[model samples]
Target: MKRLRYIALGVMVALLAWGYVAFNHWQREMIFMPSRAVGHTPPNGSFSDQWIDAPAAGGVEGGKVHAWWLPAASPEAPALLYLHGNADTLSTNVAAIDRLRQAGFAVLAIDYRGFGASAALLPEERSAYADARAAWQRLEQLAPRAVKRLAYGHSLGGAIAVELAATTPRVDGVVVEGSFTSVVDVAKSTEFDWMPLSLVVSQRFASDEKVAALKTPKLFIHCARDEVIPLRFGDRLYEQAGEPKSRLVIPGGDHNDCPAAAAGEWRDTLRRFGGISA
Candidate 1:
C-alpha cells in the first residue's frame, strides 16, 4: 500500500508539470490562428499593392509586410485602416473591403506579422502592434490628402485597432467588430476558465484598457449569436469607452457574418461616426 501511494504521487506531480509546460508552449497557438494563403480577391482590380517594413524585435524577422489599398469611389472620401483578425489572411475580408469601398471610403487592409505574406516568423502582441503602426505610416504616405482617417478591426484585429486608435493622433474614428475585452477575460469565458491564464498567456490585447483612453468617436458592433467572443464582451468594451460612442447589436448574426448580415446598418453607423455622407 505504501509503495503504490508513492507511485501515484509521482505520477500526479509529473502530470501537473507537463500540463504547465504544455499550456505555456501552446497558448499563442490557441489565441492566434494565422493562415499563410490569401483566401479571396479584391473586386474589379480596384485595390493597389502596398508593403511596409516591420521593425526589428525579438522573435521578429523585420521584413516587408504586404497590404492592399482599395480606393474610394470619390477622391475626398475618408480612409480606413483595416486590421484583420487572427485567422487567415487579409483576403478573407474581401466582402467587407468591397462594402467599405462602396460606402465611399478608401481602405488599407494589412496582414500582421506571421500572417499571410508578412515577414515575421511568429506574431505576438507587441509585434502585431508594430506591424499595424508600420502599415498606418504607409497608408499616410499613400493617401496624405484623405479627408479623414478611421480604424476598423474585426475579432482579434479589434483589439489591435483599438490600440492603434488610442495611440495614433491622426485617427478620426474607431470601429470594432466581435472583439473581446482582453485575453484574460476571454480565457475566463472559455473552457480554460479553470486555469490561471493571467500567468500563462502572453498576448494581452487589452482593449478594455485601451478603449478608455480613446477620445475619438467609437462604434462597437457585435453579433448576439456569436459563440467565439460573446456579445457581453463587446458591451463591456462599449461601456468603458468615452463619449461619442455607438453600439450595434446584430440579431441572429454569428461571428464572421455580422457585417454582411447587417450591411446597411453597418455602413450607416460608419458614415455617422466617420462624418461621411451616404
Candidate 2:
C-alpha cells in the first residue's frame, strides 16, 4: 500500500511537470523580426527585388526590422505588401510571387523573423504586428509614387493582415486567406485546452476582435474543406467586418489549395479593391 501511494505521487508530479512545460512553451513569446532572403528571383523578372531596413514598432523588444520590395513596371502601378504564413521561409512562395506580378502588383513580401532569413527569434502576435508595420513603412518609402497600396496575408499571415487593416492607416485595402478567428478560441476547441494554453500562447493572433475594427476594403477567402482551420472562422471574421467586405468560399479546396481553387474569384476581388483593369 505504501508503494502504491509512492507511485501515485510520482504520476501526479510528472503530470504537473508536463503541464508546466506546456505552459511555458505556449507562453514563450518570441518575436522573430522579418528579413529579406535572396533566393530564386521572380519568374517573369519584371521588377527589381531588394531589401529595406526598418525599425520594429510595438514589439516586446524594440529593434530593427526588415522587409523585401519589388519595383513595379511603372511608377503609377499599385503596390502589394504581402505577409506569408507561419511555417517555412518566404522563398517558398515563388508561385504567389508569380501570381501577384501577373495581377499587376509590385509585390513586397516580408519574412517574419523566425521563418526565413529574417533576423529575430520565434514569433508572437504583437511582434508580428510590429514587423508588419515596419514593412508597411518601408513600402511607403520605396513606392512613394504608387497610387494604391494593398495588404495581403495567407494562413497565419491572414491574422496579421487583419490586425494591420484594423489599426494601420497606411494600407487602403486588405486581403486574407485561410485565417483563424482567434488562437485562444481555436485552442479551446482542441483537446489541449486542459494544458496551460494562455500562459504559453504568446501570440494570440486574435482576429475576432480586429476584424470589427477594419475600416478599409477587405477580402477574406477560406476553404470549405480546410482541415486545419475550420471554414466557420472565416465566416465569423467576415461577419465582423463593418463594411466594404467580401468573402470567397472555395467549394472543395483545403487550406493551402483554396487560393488556387478560387483564383478567378480572388483576382476579381483584388481587381475590385485595387481598381485595376483586370
The window of 10 residues in a row where model 2 has the poorest summed lDDT is 28-37
Candidate with maximal TM-score: 1
- Looking at model 2, the pairs that clash are 26-200, 26-201, 27-200, 32-113, 33-113, 35-118, 125-203
lDDT for each residue of candidate 2 in 81-179, tens digit (9 for 90 to 100): 888876545677767766886777877888765555665664556767877887888788777887799889988788888888778887889888888
Candidate 1 regions with alpha-carbon error over 4 angstroms: 1-25
lDDT tens digits by residue: candidate 1, 9-44: 999999999996676547666677767877577965
Q: Count the backbone clashes (under 3 Å) in each candidate.
A: 0, 7
My TM-score estimates for the predictions, one after another, are 0.88, 0.81
User: lDDT at 70 for candidate 2?
Assistant: 65
lDDT of each: 0.83, 0.73
lDDT of 2: 0.73
Model 2: per-residue Cα lDDT at residue 3: 100
